[model samples]
Target: MRTQIHSHLQDNQCLELFILEGDASRIRELSHLLNRNIKTVYSKLVSLPHE
Candidate 1:
């Protein structure tokens, strides 16, 4: 897991990035949860080719 946080003191805002790996279904479920949260400004899912 890797993450990064950015804060804007002037606007009192924060941005976050979370990189996750696992089953596609599980990831989609988590994405839905985040999107439902008002705090989530944006969310994206990226899949890499695997054997």
Candidate 2:
């Protein structure tokens, strides 16, 4: 179950990274661009592997 959740979270982070097109600034800007809570994004990012 933990692995499954981790996989899902990693997938989400990948999707976010793709959407940002490798742009660090735009990735950081996602909070305002997508109107999502930044902490949520940050948490997922930290949970994922570091490539």
Best by TM-score: 1
What is the lDDT for 13 in model 1?
62
lDDT of 2: 0.42
lDDT score for residue 27 of model 2 = 55
Tens-digit lDDT string for candidate 1 (1-51): 555566664466666666766687887898799889997777777777766
Q: lDDT per model, in order?
A: 0.73, 0.42
Worst 10 residues of 2 by lDDT: 1-10
Query: When superposed on Cα atoms, how far off is each prediction in RMSD?
Result: 2.6, 10.0
In the predicted model 1, the residue pairs found to clash are none
Best by the lDDT measure:
1
Candidate 2 segments exceeding 4 Å error:
1-21, 32-51
